[model samples]
Every structure is written in structure tokens, then in C-alpha cells.
Target: MTATIIHLATPEDTVRLGQDLGLALRKGDLVLLSGDLGAGKSTLARGLIRTIADDRDYEVPSPTFTIVQSYPDLRLPISHVDLYRLSSADEVDELGLDEALMEGAVVVEWPERAEGALARPSLSVALVSDGEGRKALIDGETAALARLQRSLAIREFLAASGLAQAERRYLLGDASARGYETVAAGTEQPLILMNSPFNPGGPVLRDGKTYMQIAHLSQSVSAFVALDRLLSSRNYTVPKIHAGDLENGFLLLEHLGGDGVLDADGAPIIERYEETIRLLANIHQQAWPHEAEVGDGTMHHIHEFDRDAMMIEVELLSDWYVRRISGIELDGVQKAAYVAAWDAVINQLNGCETSLLLRDVHSPNILWRRNEVGIRRVGLIDFQDAMIGPSAYDVASLIFDARVTISPYLQDHLLGVYIHERNSAGSDFDEPDFRKALAIMAAQRNAKILGIFIRLDERDGKSYYLKHLPRIQTYFDRVVRHPALAPVREWCEKAGIFSPES
Candidate 1:
């Protein structure tokens, strides 16, 4: 419903904007190209095609003579069409444009000849001459237009922040909507570009609060900036923030190198694991303020990982995992009992002394920097969801990681290392109490992961997460053995969740 007009002052601007559109393009989408001859329609199309192919030097021959050209090697098929030579809309149909629409995205030049056959809620790019440059107006439906606006926003961020001329390369993206890129400009030590927009999830799950509110998830890039300062102050390797547009959710951070804690076989490196544990041991003892300043005279108030947040995370088990394994959702009575069980444990968990919890201290978020000294050797990313919670929570996250299996022997050794380190700093650190809390937190974390993984599969179609269910089940089987989590163990047994093992 919104129209966005971007001033494409240069060919580079046009190309970068197209790349943004290309990244957001999905299968079965239509992009209508409208412009005069030599109006940069072909240039824009080339940029879009090259981005999808991930080839900077990709040759995109104009399809004016051929009517249409298809690229099958791309992640999705792309059909580049030229309708100027077409006689009528019927001739367009004879080219099997309908079938191409069924298969992949279609980008059509001179779309007006089709007489509005292109479909509504479509992206129409109008490229007109503007003095020494070109200006483009993007008109489309709300959803599609929103995506294009985000792309323009990113381009503006890069431009206004002096990174307009940087070379960009795709880095990584997760099951979530977030994506990252590496920016290299001249001799500048390459920076990481995080394109994480605040994702406000759907309807009121409870108390008029959405899932993010209950889970204490990062709703803005400001959270990452704040937590980055908090962790960096303690010598943790949260990436150094270079420039950021918090409103647009674009962050340019110092590139922490590519060495991960996982070896070639994808197992956790013992040496790195020990270092990660030691880092957590050291971090948990520090006094992190609830209020952190994120530079530019802005103060970010960190939200605590309180009862509602803890309970909401653990409820993921009942939400998705139960339906997958038991073939039904948790009924009213079962849900009530599950909630009561978690509520009681959360109360006891609150009694334990708390510290900053790196909610995802697992292998993927950890990078091994061998040359860096001490805790800085473990480069931390994704601590945007960091909150004040039990130190044992992060301990559980590290040892009982979801992505990588920490063997029983290594798990015990690492657990020992973590406990000894904590004891060194905390005089009144109760080993037995901490161990019980670790078990409680592990069970909660593993259960939440089970639901999250299954939801990723069922709803988001990320079946790759299903591969970790056995490991998660094993973690559940082990952690629920704690007397404090007996209620959860009983529920799991009744649900027949532990009938199989890895």
C-alpha cells in the first residue's frame, strides 16, 4: 500500500538496491520493469540476477531478442523477459510465462505491453532519467513494498555511514529472518554487516504480550549494542561496534575471524570448550549493571530474565514437541500441570544468585581466536538476547549444547572446570545448589530447544533441526534425573519421549 521512491544517484546505487531486492526475492514473485530505452532497467535486472547467482562478474545478456532467458542453476530459477518485441498479451502467454510464474520469479521489462496482466501486489520499478543520474519509484503491495523499503533503508545506512563504496559478500543467515554480510572497503579490516530488523511476532499469546516480550528477546539492534558494551567491558569478545543505524537495524561491527570452536567433523574442540567454560566462569562473577549506555547519549535498560520469561521459554516443549511426538497438542489439564510444574521450579531458581546469561553460549555463537589472550580468545556473537539470570543457565548452555554433543567424559571435565573457576571468585558459591540449578536450567533449555526445533520444522520447514532431537532428548533424559526436575522427568516418561536414544 506504500510507495517508496529511491534516488539512484549512481549505477552502484542501482545495483546495490537491486541486490537488496534480489536477497528478498522468493519463488513465484513477479518484478515488473518499466522504463525508457537505456533507462537502466537492464542494469537493475543484471544486478538482481547476479546477486541471486552470487556471482559478481556474472554475464546477464539482455533477453530482448530471445523474448525470455532462464537461469536454472540459481537457488531458484530466474526468468529474465523482454516484452518490447511482443505483438500482444496473447503472444506473452504463448511463451509459457504462466509456467515460469509457477516455477520461479519472473522479471519483465516493458511490462506495460502486457496490459496489467502482471498481477497486483507486484513490485513495479519505474526508472526515469534525472539529470546526470537515474531515479526510481517502487510501488507495490504492503508486504512486498516493506521488503523493498528495508533494502533501501540498508542502502541509505551504508551510504550515510560512509560504507557506500564497500564491497559486500554474503556471510550467513539463520533459521530466523536475520542475515549477515561482510563489508570490505580498501584497506579497512573487513567489518561484519548485521541486517537484523526488529521482528515483532504475531498476536497476543498472553497478557497482551507477544512471544518476544515474554521471552525477553532482542526487539531492536540497540539490545546488541548495549549487551556488546556490557560484555566487552569484562573483556569478552563481543564484536566492536563500528557504526550503526538502530532505527534501520543495520550494524557494522569489527570482523572477528572465522575459526570456530567446532573442528572439521563438527564436534566441539576440547581446548576451545575448556576456554569457553573458563570465560563463562569469569563472566558470571562480574557485576553487570541493569542499565547500559549504548553511546550517543542513549541508555538501554536491560530487562531481567524473570518468571514470565523463564516459563515462556520452557513452554516451547509443550507447544511444538508434544504435538510432534504424541500426535496431539497439550490439552487444558496437561498444560495446566506443566505450567504449575515450571512455576514452582522457577520460584526456587529465583532464589539462586543471578548473573548475565548468554542465552546461546553454544558452539555456533562461539568463535575460537587462538592468537587473542585469555577470555578474549573466545569471540562472542549473538549475545543480544543476554539477560540477568542464573550463572548455571549459561553453564548448561555451554556443556549441554544443542548443535554439538559434549561427550559425557568431556561434559564432566568441563563442568568441573566451570565449577572450580566459579568457586575461585565466589566465596559462598554453593556447589550442590549450583549443580541442582544447572540441572534445572539444562532441562528448561533443552525442552525449549525441542519445541523450537520442531516448530522450525513444522511451521518454518526447517527439517535440519530434527537431526538434533536425539541429542536434545539425551540432554533431557540426563538433566531430568535431578530431584528438583522430577516433575518434568515424570511428564516425559508419561509422554513416552525417552523410548529411543542416539
Candidate 2:
């Protein structure tokens, strides 16, 4: 079953549709209103809020001047944010819209201004005005949308094409614009199928009867291309691209299923960490041939890890999450300590050799699969940001992960296993030197993660990441606790980098 697109006959119908959707709204759910100017965007938002609030006198005007307007009087405090006034993505966070998202329902006008800021919706209502009528398309997640879309009868036409069953099934999961879907043709076989008006980077069904991820072109396309090239030489598993219309940012790919490595239940923490480290070792071992193809050069360079760039990100954390939200002002001594600690870490990194490092190697980027031996195997994803850098960069990312917390014991055991594997692989790395490199890289990775989490919540309206800050900080503390990193730790402490009050 897939979601069906319906047309509304009048403005009244649009309001009614909004009211219907408002009745179903829940906490932490996002409603994105996308339409042209005067396409009844605000009118629809007004109807939704009115239905929930039921207060006739509540003024529901366009929030043009004020980026976000909150109405807490309703059953669920509704946040009416108008991004039309936003000058840049950074300004979105300053408006404190993320807080509104956390408390109640969010009705966003000109949401495209902060498109990636919101999570994938549970329902998306696109209003297209035509003459005296409007088009109202409702996309429900999984069950509701699938049942509706299948009733529309376009499924047969899509299936007859090269599109596979699995492709159709996956597309049915899309709660946004229809592009392609993955469906299961048989109990074991899946195929990729196409949806009309294909949006670049949106998911699509491929000829092999599997669903592929095609969400956005700018970053996803580049990332997948790099992953494709890497898979050609390594034993690692990434979603295989069956068919790609790169110009349109659409690709048919093999579905790796929804069960990711990090989502494994009751798995031993050390085992998970060990599997991940082994895969990283495999990635580092497979050297790219001089003639091997490379992805677009937009990836970050380790050489770009200069003093200025590092300081800018450190300042971002200090300004946004720490100072602005947490109200912790850095004293002069603390500031100087942070600077010195950062410099020491960077100076150490400057001396180590570099390799192809996947910048984002956290939980979400890895998929866990069951192997024949009943043990779980880890598969990597989201490597478009891969770059030439220190091998420890990836190790730090896995051990000091932001999404999940790994105990110090597991971290040490995993690190030992990784070192053993690397040494056995005939690499001539100095143990002492490698340990130092790991500490240096761990500090840099944690610093970058802090800034990213802030950006994700404040700038992007994804506050779920805020809860992981303490865990990530623990990783920083662990690294700095080492004798080799004592100087850096002293610097961080002096700077109040880990100040409990801060």
C-alpha cells in the first residue's frame, strides 16, 4: 500500500483537510506546508491551528516579521514558524524554533528555507491552488499511505516496468513527494520500481527489484558515488547502485533492509565495537590504485585542519550550545586553555601520516547484518564525506560515537583488537606513536561532533542530538585522561572545556 494524492475542490476543502490532519497531530511530529506565494499556505496553517486551539479570537496571521510564533493555549502548544523572514540557515537556530518543535506541533510556512532542518514527516500536505480549487495530497507513513497509494491503482503500471516489488514496497514508505518505491515481488526477492516526477536523490526502485536511496543530489549523490568506487576494491558492503540517473539524482539500488548494525538488540558491546574496528582495518588495508577512480573533490581535506578552522568550530560550540543556551561564559583563563589544548592536539596530528577516512562513522552510518556463523557483521554507509586523513580519525568516530554510548572498558578492548589486527596486517606503525595519534584524532573528532550536534539542533531543528552531548564529552575526557594527552587535558581543563557548570 502507498499514499494517494488527492485534489481539493475548494479553499474550504483545504481548510477541512488541515483540520483533519491537525486532529491527528502528536508531539514531536512536524508538518511542512510547501506552496507558491498566496497558495493558501497560511490559510491552511490557520485552519489547522484553529481546529486544535478552538479559540475564535486567537490571531493566526502570517508570521513574516517574527520567524516563529508560539500558541501554548491549545491542547498541544503549536509553533507557527515562518521561515520566509530567515536570512540564513544559522539564523533559524537563533529564533529558538527547535524548542517549539520539542514542546508541540510545528506548522512551518516557507519550510524550504530550512528544508533539511526538519525530520522526515509523518504526513506532508502540499497545497497547489488552481482557479477556485486546490490540490491536497496526503502521504501517510508505511501503513496508512501505502494502503491509500495502492488504492489509486498506479502500482500495476509501475510494476510492469523494470521496477521490482521491493522497490515498490520501499517507495510506499515515502511520506513525501513520490519518486520511486521498492516492493517485494516474492518472499525472498525484491525489486526497485520508479515513481513519477522523480526528485533527485529521492529513493527509487531499481531493475534488480530492490529499493535505492535517492534523497538529495548535492551531498547524497557524491557520497554514493564514492561508496560505489570503494566497494569495487574492498570487502565492505554498501548499497549497490543498480541504475543511476545522476543528472536527475535518481538511482536504483539493493536494499540493505532496515535493521542497522547499531540497532542490534542485546548484542555484546565489545563484539559490536570489535566488528566495526575490523571493518575499518579492512578499509584502510585496501589501498586505492593510483589509477583508481576518485569521487568529486568536495570532500574535506586533512590539510584543511588548520588552527583557524579548528578555532572557528570551537567558537561555534561556545557561542551556540554552551554560552547561548547553557549560559556558560568562558573566562579568560578558560578561553586560553581551550586554545592551547586545541593547538596541542592539532600540532600532534600534523606529524602523522594520512589515509582515506570516513568523516561520519557513527551508528546511523552503519548497518548490522547476521552472518552464517550467527555472529553479526557490520556494513558501512554514509561515507560521501570520506577524505584523505589520519586512520585514527575513523577509529575515534566509532569509539566516541555520538548516537550511542560505549563504556571505557569496551573502548579499550576494541582499541586493543584494532591495534592487534592492524599490526598483524603487516603495517609498520609505532605503538606509542599510534596511541598518541588516536588521542589527538579523538579530541578533534569530538570537537567537530559537538559543533555538528549544535548545528543539527539549533540550525536544523533536530534537537534529539542534544541529549548525546554528555556522552560525547565523556569520550573527550577519556582521551585527555591519558598520560600522552596530559598536556592537552590540562589545557582543556584550564579553558573550562569540560567544566561541569559549563
* Best-performing candidate as measured by TM-score: 1
Query: Candidate 2: which stretches are off by over 4 Å?
Result: 1-220, 262-269, 289-315, 324-337, 372-376, 483-488, 497-502
lDDT tens digits, residue span 159-193, model 2: 33354222222233122233344544454735444
lDDT of each: 0.83, 0.61
RMSD of each: 2.9, 13.6
Residue 211 in candidate 2 has what lDDT? 19
Candidate 1 residue lDDT tens string, 185-226: 565468888999878966679998999888888878888898
Q: Model 2 misses residue 303 by how many Å?
A: 8.5
